[model samples]
Target chain A: MAESKWTPKEPMVSAKDVHKSFGDLEVLKGVSMDVMKGDCVCVIGPSGSGKSTYIRCINALNPIDSGSIEVEGQEVNDPHLDKLELRKKVGMVFQQYNLFPHKTALENIMMAPMRVLKEPKDEVETRARELIKKVRLEGKEDSFPGELSGGQQQRVAIARSLAMRPDVMLFDEVTAALDPETVKEVLVTIRDLAEEGMTCILVTHEMGFAREVANHIYFTDRGVIVEHGPPKTFFTKAKDPRTKEFLSQIL
Target chain B: MSARTLIPGITARATTDLPVLKPFKGKPYGHDEIGFSRFLANLSPWAVVCVVMLLALWPMAAMAQAKYTIGDAFDALWKWVPFLVTKGFALNILISVTTMAIGTAAGVLLGLWQISPHPAIQKTAWAVTQAFRNSPWLVLLFIVMLAFPFEITIAGVTIPIPDWMKAVFGLSLPIMANISEVVRGAIQSVPTGQWEASESLAFSRNQTLWRIILPQCFKRMIPPWMNWYAILTMATPLVSLLGVEEIVTLSRQAMEGENNHPELLIPFYGFCLVIFFAYCYPIARWTISLERKFSVKL
Candidate 1:
């Protein structure tokens, strides 16, 4: 196994012995991982491998049954933890855009900032417009999500998450739902964020994007991290038989 | 479609400025310069209304000679309608508005309670709402009307609860119960992704409901709400059984006035039908329009 190049300083997110189950089906079996500041970690695995569940646990979106997760010194697994407050520090983007159908692209980006942050409308509008432009949805600001294409809507979703100025972003198959031609735009937007040093944890099937954007590659299966290392070695020199098997099918 | 047509300033700047058209640059049309076609278009709405009214009243006119003339029935209507407006119709409006206000507020609370995180609270609210919803409106009204006293002592002082108040309370109980179902349905109709997206944004449960979920629900609830309101309005006539002197009571009194001719009975009842259709038709149309406007895919 190749060692991680970046040494841990102030870990942005740390999950220890995290386990989650859906009734009798145990999805997460004592999975553990750490995401440090500015680390672009890509989580990869097969279907029902708990890849999505593990990342969701980091933000306490999926409540862990055992073990703990801490993000920016906030104990996410605490019984009294303020989920709303914890979520503000971590922005999440899903495979489905989930943009408010009623709201315009600009409004979708502006909503959380104005309502949750209680920021001034003018300030939020300025940042939201900037983010919309950043997402390459400049002229489409007034358009509603229903009017936009899949790629455009996904970009708006990214901009909406970025509008909160989150410290860490969790992307769960952000581009998985996109059409082939439109997928590039969303990947490029995420690549821009990763290059900007935004601490991101992504569960994705795009091996090429993962190799390019993610510094650390974690191979997860049946709810645990079976192997993790630098992308160069993890892809080319994976030690585990399972990682090799998973990579073989995908790559 | 061109910008020049929309903003006449462009035309004014483009051509030699005419004093006649310059003053009306921003207005829809210039005064005393009406186009014949545009004037016809403007009058179309009033013409349509007149045609419909004529068609509606024609049936009464054709049946006029058979009994009391339609003219006499209308004259009687003119007299009794004003009397009913001040005495009976006003009460209907009051009962309807009051019931809607009180019922909607109580319903929202009960509906939210039904979905409360606590299992006990949820089940309790569910049971109470279900009980109220399952009971017939008239039966429920009768029970309240018969069970409660006219006055109740509170802090050594008696507060009078009049018959109308009893009727209002009775009407509101079922309204509240039905509205609760509407509220529950509307909330449930919102997709789970909306909740997840809003929650992931760090919005509190209340915030998510009020800002994200409820706004979307408001659209889904409107058509059903308006339908319920129309039903409630028609049911207000039932309060006449409790001697409330509402529209139905006044209609009976009006019919009794012309008992000698008795043939006027159909016209009197027809008047009530017209009143109800006049009130409900627009509401139904408006609800449909709003449904189309606010339709969400997910």
Candidate 2:
């Protein structure tokens, strides 16, 4: 496939025919996608379709069996690739809202910047407070993860990822574990981030949220990207039978 | 007793006050009776053990000739009480504390190595932990006491290793192995999500362990660590077998000093049991409380 004629800036994240496996099971077979700067890309797939694995490969969290993933033009699969450096630029929020349970909401957001980046405490605290408010957890700065609702914890997790000042954000079904009522609050937070032009690749089951927020949509099935296009066209006029079947069941 | 008096919480006065019923009359057999029985029921196991020992020793004391009475054994015990506690038991406490400190430090490292990404380090640590964890503590104590040189020379300077110190070193080997299991279990108890979250935040593995993983494991490790300390304290008597002059050895010497009367055996040895039980029982209770307090909610 030729490069898109319209993307003026270089793709911030690019996966070229990425192949990954876990022992006997092949999770990702020649998967590829380009996430441009400030674009919201949604990857919607069935449970075993390797959507999470693909994004995890992008951040070097899981190395690919065979293929290339580059973030900001640095080869992620390189043996000598400084994963810490790659992760600094690419932030991920887990589906479980993996907030540090022992830490307060504010401290959770402040931790990476203060510890990993060695940022000054006062500066990190000030920014952390702002991010807490950005996620609309204003009065819960001191609340530990166990005390917070699932939505509140998920929002704090997003704020934690944002604390690193990352170039790209990866959301691995961040709202999947939330109560129905609380899911909107987390979605609104993500929508606000997208509107502010943060580069994002979300692997989600929330198709309605995807169509509303994502500029591009990729439908994965059976370890491959079966169809992808602009969300408007991709949702309505999916060409692949597998994509149509998946959309029919979920929608 | 009147039917009304038999009803719970009704006093004899509240029932019918009759001279014939006066014998059975007082407070109802409610709270006070339950309280007395509960007191007996809740009696410390240590106290029960002491009572049983006294009861069991009484017959032997009675069977002894008129030459040395049970009262004579008491007098001998009273004479040596201060020396036995201050010198002998103090060594036991010292050895336990020192062995625990050394074991904990070494065990934590071994535990970390057991989970190291490197196969060689992980295997070696696992083998070392298994080797010491399964070996009998007494056997290890004997090996260290007998095999280790009494002193060593380094840099033209000689440092003498005391017998008690050697006993401490021996005791620490098993303690280290057991503590290593404790540390490994504690670390593994923390969810994998923590590692992934820390990784995404760009924390190095070392940073993740010290900053994220270890702090959580610390609370989980404490109760078990204290439990091990209690076990170590009880096992300190094994050092007396090596003739390191701990409580048991001192008690034997004290009996000898009292002309080795056969009646001296009960008081001297029984005192050692009581002292050890006194020291370890509270720790066992505290460890249980700590375990409850620190148990992970999820």
Report the number of the highest-lDDT candidate.
Answer: 2
**Residue-by-residue lDDT tens digits, candidate 2, B130-156:** 999999999999999999999999998
Tens digit per residue, CA lDDT, model 1, B170-274: 999988888888888778878888888988998888888888888877767766676667678868988889887788788888778866354456556666666
Colliding residue pairs in candidate 1: none
> DockQ of each candidate's interface versus the true one?
0.44, 0.56
The global C-alpha lDDT for each of the candidates, from Candidate 1 onward, is 0.82, 0.87
lDDT for model 1 comes to 0.82
- Report the CA-based lDDT of candidate 2 relative to the real structure: 0.87
Q: By DockQ thresholds, what CAPRI class is model 2?
A: medium
What does the i-RMS of model 2 come to? 1.0
Q: Which residue pairs come into collision in candidate 2? A: none
The number of the candidate with the highest DockQ is 2
